[model samples]
Target: MAHLRDDSRGQLLLVAGLALALVFIGLALVVNSAIFTENLASRGETAGSSGALAARAATEANAGTAIEQANHYNPSAPVDAFNRSLRNVSTQTEALSATSGTLSNVTYAGHRNGKRVSGAIDRTNNSYTVADSVERVSGANGTRGLVFNASDLPGESTPLVVKVNDTTATGDRNSWRAQIWETTSDVHVKTFRNGTSASENRTERCSVPSSTANRIEVTAGLVNGQPCDALRRNDSGANFWFGNGAGDEYDVHFKNTNYTTGDFEMVVYSGGGPSILLTTLSDDAIYDAEVQFVYDGPDVWYNTSVRVAPGEPDA
Candidate 1:
């Protein structure tokens, strides 16, 4: 009887050992699977982040190219340029993304120009998202520009504030002027040429700072019976009759007033639109400009804007 009991105990011990071994095998498989899952997740995150950044780069390049192309178009007319840019961006998006739907459409807005634009690029199984946009950055160069045509600001009675800052480039080439006239102010002229000069009958007159080193800040309003004045010029072309010669290059930097905005800069503001006076000095010579368009009632000007940075934007 004792020998039988011993044999039974041995069989029980062998069964328990087998069960323990099976449990260990099952545990090993679970641990291995967990590690593999973690590794895959890490890799996927890294790849997605990289792809998103790449997409941003592609879209930004496209945006900049569009803006340059737009710049060559009619500076007065911006819609055509915007359309052209949108088309180019579409082509760029195609190159950047695997699917058309994955990339976001390009868009733009501005008062006087298509100065600001936006878009997005997506990549890699939609694992991550990349957004891109571009803005017109001025002041990098030492020049500024603005325009106020016939249609920009219509009515003549609106008040205006004309401001000017003097630069060291005076006398021989320094030019700062404000032109004004009523029914007698309009001057009939043809295309501009070098040494363009005209003598207008006594009605509207032109004014420029005699002191090249002086700064000017004047507002034209219906104080007594006079409307606000603006940065004005009647003559066009190099060596204009209105001047001691040379173009009246005003700084078109409106927002920044520290006078540190550009190489030679000035800012002009007017409640009413600016009067029409073409740049008589029609040389390829670069000059800063500002334009105020008269839409419905209030005049509109192109607001300055910034573009996407090389780094990631804040969410």
Candidate 2:
């Protein structure tokens, strides 16, 4: 009986040894699995971080390209290209779960060395952000001649301020001459020949030479209730005569009763003769002539005449 008991005990010890080995194998498998899982998690985190960084970089790059293109090339082309690139980047980033993570706050910012540039940003769900700015740049050659056309004249008696830039050497503002033509009979022309000729008789009388034709002639300068030597000579051309050899200063003023129908035309001249011909007439004959720039040691001067006319005025 004792021998049988010892055999059973040996069999029990072998079974216990087998059970211990199986437990150790199971523990080893568990530890290896934990290590593998940790490695996978670390790799996923790194991939996600990289994707996010890539998306950010793409956004910045697209913004920069768009701004640069707008400065040099056509503004629309670069803007469109930038918008497309941004959309592409946004789409790609949103699709990548590893990049954006659980946050949905994805945005693209545009700047030039910390200075915010003008552009348009399109977000999700058709939402967008836009920024714009305007800058004026001057020309290198400066201003040319006085830019005057038939669009800048005054229509009423509103007080106007005329600005003149002296680009020429001529200091004499009165050197510039203007030829004015009256269209109505009520409007009269007056000329002042120095202070010695009296002030009241500065107006020149207008008369109809022939009844058949509507030709009007201004003959003889009114001086102190008498006719002066300055006469409207019909010898050479149709022009107001200021004496044969008169070197005196003259100031001409036109007065009209009706401001609406009263019309006149004028052209600027440099020396004795007129420069440009008076082809057009203004309804309200009121103009101010000022000297502007002069070129080549004041030999040629640029002048601007602002006429307040009835209709649309010229600049």
Candidate 3:
């Protein structure tokens, strides 16, 4: 009887030890599983952050396109038209993102009013007024989206000169000018703070070696899609933007218009109406828009505000 009791006690002790070992194994498995779940969550958050930034960029691009379309097609009520377009963009973006198990959206916040003035610079050689008494956008001190598309520019002797005259001031000392011409192998844009006399005024020049340089984005500071120092912000106090240093309002005139052959366009923000020289393709167009973007993923949520101005100069 004593030997049987000893064997029973040993078996009972072994069973307790095995049970404790099993409990320890279960705890380890639980801890490892928790660590793995945390790692997956972190990875998901990182991917969501990247997706949000990409979505914001896409929203800005789409908003810019919407503004252009509204100005060109719904000039009478561009702001209202732009908002409608934004709604469609939001719906499309959300639907596309759903395929990736995410939600993204773009919502219109607001817009700035302006006019899109476009047309031939001049069919004849006669100089004429491009716009008169055009005021700068209320908050900003300059105009935007001023571009020249010249297919046939004359030589320096008869270059096309664009002048910006202060409404309340006159003379070479108070105006900004851009003289454009082309040579056998290059196209040139000469900017003047006040007058065309290079020795008497602050002047700078930008030239492109390609004979096919036709596009000149003036306010955006690009020549033939290349950066040009003459048209951009300069610390020397001479910027070629029409409204710069021109007071509250200015008149845009083309001197020797017959020197260049092409179309030009610009947008001015003001309460005044468009000049007859400009077709006023859009009376009350939206020049820029602000949008709110949102992105939602399994492990992250992001929201941001972006302003879309397609041709505004780089800050």
- Candidate 3 lDDT score at position 96: 89
Model 1 per-residue lDDT at 54 = 56
Say which candidate scores most in TM-score.
Answer: 3
| Per-residue lDDT of model 2, residues 1-315, tens digit only | 345578788998999999999999999999999999989877776655554444445444443443334322443243344445546644554455334232211333331111112211111212111111111111111101111111122222421111111222122232111122233332222332222223411323332211211111222232222332223422343233432112222222222212222112221112222112111211111111111111111111112221111111111
Q: What is the lDDT of residue 241 in candidate 1?
A: 24
Best-matching candidate per lDDT = 3
**TM-score of each candidate?**
0.29, 0.22, 0.71
Clashing pairs in 3: 125-258
Which candidate do you rate higher for TM-score, 1 or 3?
Answer: 3
Off by over 4 Å in 2: 1-7, 44-49, 60-105, 108-315
lDDT (CA) for every model shown?
Answer: 0.30, 0.28, 0.76
How much is the lDDT of residue 191 in candidate 3? Answer: 81
Candidate 1 residue-wise lDDT at 208: 31
Total clashes for model 1: 22
Q: Rank candidates, TM-score, best first.
A: 3, 1, 2
Worst 10 residues of 2 by lDDT: 134-143
